[model samples]
Target: VAAGPAPPGTAPGGRRPWRQLALLSGLISMDSSESSVISVLFPALRAALGLPLSALGTLVAVGKLAGMVTGPLWVMLAQRVSRKTVLVISSGLWGVWSIAAGLSQNYVQLLILSTIAAAGFAGGGALVNGILADLFDDAHRGRAAGYLYAGVAVLLAVVGPLLGLLSEVHNGWRYGFFLSGAVTVAFGLLVAAFFRDPGVGAAENPGVGAAENPGVGAAEPHRGGPARPGATVLNRAVLRELMSSRTFRLILVQRFANTQLAMVSFGVVYLVDVFHFDNATASLVSAPAAICFLIGTALGGQIVDRVQRRLPDAGRLLTWQLATLGWGVAALLATQVTWPSIGIYVVLFCVLGVLQGFNPGCNRPILMAVTRPETRSAAFAVMLSAESAGWAASTLAIGYAGSAFGLRTAVLWLVVVLNLANALFMTLIHRPLRREALALRAATADTHPRTSGAENR
Candidate 1:
């Protein structure tokens, strides 16, 4: 078929958000699968190296700590440099480091190599998230984000077991890393060749080009476009603007508390150590639960979008946030019990997986709603840094606690308490999110009067 005319306002060669969503999804999948696949190799690693449980925890903690510093650094650099260039460089470098991690002869070598890889990997989250916001307008961002994150969950589900099978072979885990790294390096080249910038503020309001191109025949330039040059990386003005937003502050706190559920880091370990399942068996069972989670993500995204259309003023998104927490609570209860059959354990985990997946479809869209397009990347970077810190601390704590007590007790206590705290923190965002969302929409309409017609209403 002959190509259709480029969509209005899209750059000559730029791909539409939906079209690019799949490519970005592939990037996200490759970025995360390495970590997921590695988690499954923990048992083989321990057996081969004669390492302890604490070593695994230390690796996870140190890697996350590396991400905490590098996440924001990548965002700042992207603002000064460009998104596509930064992404390509970071992806290529990390791919090399990940392959090196597999060749480590000792625990110390592996830890150091993995942390260096993680610092490079940190660019993916904030940079990709910001690009996503520019691709889809406000109305479709919820579903768009859903499709992207569902890819991550699905990729992890597949690679987790494949790596487990590999771990059964002598020195097979090293080969798995080699394959993953090779795939990532190839993908990075593709991103550099094909991925478009989408330009900041490209999709703030549908049917409006003013946000992307200001000062066209107008008395004054529109304020809705991206930040101008000469603004320093993480300038004080941007920091103050972000800090002043109540919604931003509340979301940051919620993100920190929620990281306690970084259970995937130790989930396979949990099954192997406590439930007495082999690595392959645990991964096989977890795969179906991941599918259940993907289903929940699809349903959650559609339901929340419909609710937002119906009750934009009320805390509809917040209601879904609470619903997610309710699912977590149920999953926690299920895990706490000893079932007569392993099938029941699988069923409970599926429930937990589904519940866990519900939040991602809504969370990033919430952040986009409150912040300007220019600042969205920084916003994500800030949130990620805080989240990484939380994860690092929790991983260290759980590792030590599991050694002193047991994995079951440590996971149970931390998951239950932190989640309850997260639920309470979410309540504070209900009003602030509602208020900020209105302000953003109104500002977009005012800046782009062409879209202020009934099409926007």
Candidate 2:
């Protein structure tokens, strides 16, 4: 496989790359905050509506289901239109739905509005992951993902306290939702007006190759040539090719199993219910964990990148991924034991946060390595859809289980078992990774002969 020279914006560079990273991270943070905010505001929402605790599960499940359906559609739209255009439109529209959700008069209306907002939120991961791959080549992807996700974690941490305060007010949760929606809408417009779309394979086709195809990232029609060939084409054959990869399928399954943790949707609730912390205290306690998560994310990404560089054909990335999952399983299992004090629990939470941090840096880099650029968005769409299904399944199951068996028991049981399953599923990806990595590099070279030629030179 042609592992050509490192592409542009792939490593230490100027502020432009950081600026792009910050913008994309901010977008994702906004989307992620929606999911977190709901959890923080759940108790208040339930009290106001006179709803049972189980309603939270339904709320989460419905949103996940909606995301499952719409994720692929966004991928298809991005294929036909500009990635930037699709993202701007989806983000803007969803922001409207998000705001309207706050105004819902009843449970059903709230559910419906939240689901609509989720449908728009679902598209973000597919678009952003695909775009990031183009912005930074393989060498730098780990650190880039780490920084992006760390920013998200930090941002969410910062807002969690505010949301907690909102929960104390009679109708304050509504304002939190309204504020989130308006901010997202504003960011969406900013992205539309200012965000530049890096070419589809711009990182891989650096130097003169990239310059020759300045229009690669846009929605404009190809002129006097066959369609510009890259890895991210949308069609049956491409889909089939993507599906055929055993590593990719395993990656998807691992993702599915991981989502079964359901922590993101219910973590704060677990802390409150099990530890007897009030809303504000629960949110505040979780804040430090987010900082730990950020550090772990940054450190883990750097370690994996260094490991891969030193052991190119040794499959160190797989080792790091599996290790991260193993750590997660252990940390989660530790949470099952009733802790003697809040301090001990916070320590466990921080450990879990670090484990959680390891994943973001590893997962997409694996996907990008095993697949080509044209297939990347489709690959992400499928991945996101599977993740949504997992989220729906886990949220509903845990939500109901929590209502019956107790939140702590239900969450702990699921986290331990499902993460173990995910780790096992990831093993199947191990043997195939080298082969897939070679295939992706070969395909990239084949798709862009100029890149191959430059590598040869």
Candidate 3:
């Protein structure tokens, strides 16, 4: 398919966003499958390996920490090489190792393999967003990102219930991880063999031997002055650019808060412990939350493009997240009720889904706005690194808090605090978002135009 790089002020429903969404969808299946498959198997793992809850908590913490450790290396590399290369190699390794994790016999082996697999998690988030940044001009970034997250939502929807049902069958847990790994590997191969760098004009790649076609447009200009693939994280200027942006800070800070709350959703054991459900039952029950999340994401993705047309500010997006956070907190509070019915539990699961849905849809717009095209990947790395730090900190703090104060009580407090913090950070970021977006718009207007036929109403 020929890519139509419409000049600025082009009509909606073009080809780039669709292609990019396809790319993101394929890549995100790796992540969603990894999480869902394991979430379903956590019970079987306990019996097979004699792993306890605290040990399980430690594994989750370590996986996230691996992302923190490896994110910047990928970012710096993206500046030097194609972000496309970084994503494929890293995520490919993630998929290969994730399968190995399923076959591990001992607890320590699982830990090691999981840590390696998680390393893929860090780099791709920023790199994929960077690819989308390059594909769509700023005017349609919200729509572009919305479409990307919608893909992720779709994958999550499939992974959740599919894995849950599979694990529920006897010995199905053993096969679930293996099949999930095969699926992820297939997706990776598709990306490696068929996926071109989204930022590059199709004319340059000519995957079917068309690069020789003189008609293809000249390779688009590269980001960050064409650093080699081994670029170091010593760019003081990039650091300054990252730190100076108030919006970037909020995105990072709220990532921390949101991740902290997300840590609770990982508590599938709570279903077993409090609700008196078995492992398979708990896993199946939690699938509804994932479904709700995907549904909400689809709705959000469809609307974001329209919203950007009219209310192009970050506040409108934040308002949606704040409401979601509030809903999740209310759901957690409901769990505290004595003799709660299954209906209320289902509603709370939906609440978790709602918050997950709102986050990726709303959050990416704020992230894309603050940084310009030149160093968007590195800028994302900086924010993601900060988020990782805050996430590591909060996970430790909250994990201990849950242990001491009781999981239910600790979570209730955390939901209130983190959402409050998320609200404050969003409010604090207004000037930066507006200012930087205007600057990005001005800079690109000559080349790309400044409208996406947005339909805010």
Which is the winner by lDDT between candidate 1 and candidate 3?
1
Q: Candidate 2's residue-wise lDDT over 351-446, tens digit each? A: 777777877778878888887766788888888888888888888888888899987777766766677766766666777887878777777687
- TM-score of every model versus the real structure: 0.89, 0.90, 0.82
Instruction: Give per-residue CA lDDT, model 1, range 342-407, as digits (tens).
Output: 677678777777777767667888888888877888888888887887877887788889899997
Against the true structure, candidate 1 reaches a TM-score of 0.89
The residue ranges of model 1 lying beyond 4 angstroms of the native Cα positions read 1-14, 205-232, 314-316, 452-457
Model 1 lowest lDDT segment of ten: 213-222
Across 1-457, the per-residue lDDT of candidate 3 in tens digits comes to 4334444432122233465467766686576566555555666666667876555556666777888878877777665655556666776545777778878878898888877877776777777766665455444555566566666656655665566676567656557667767777677667776555534321111121112321211123323222112222427887787778777766676676664344443446666655676765666545566667666666665565556566676544654556555765755454566455555666776776666566555666667665655566676677666766665565555556766776666555665456555666566667777787767555544433323222122
Model 3 / residue 289 / CA error / Å: 2.0
**Winning model by lDDT:** 2
How does each model score on lDDT? 0.71, 0.73, 0.59
Clashing pairs in 1: none
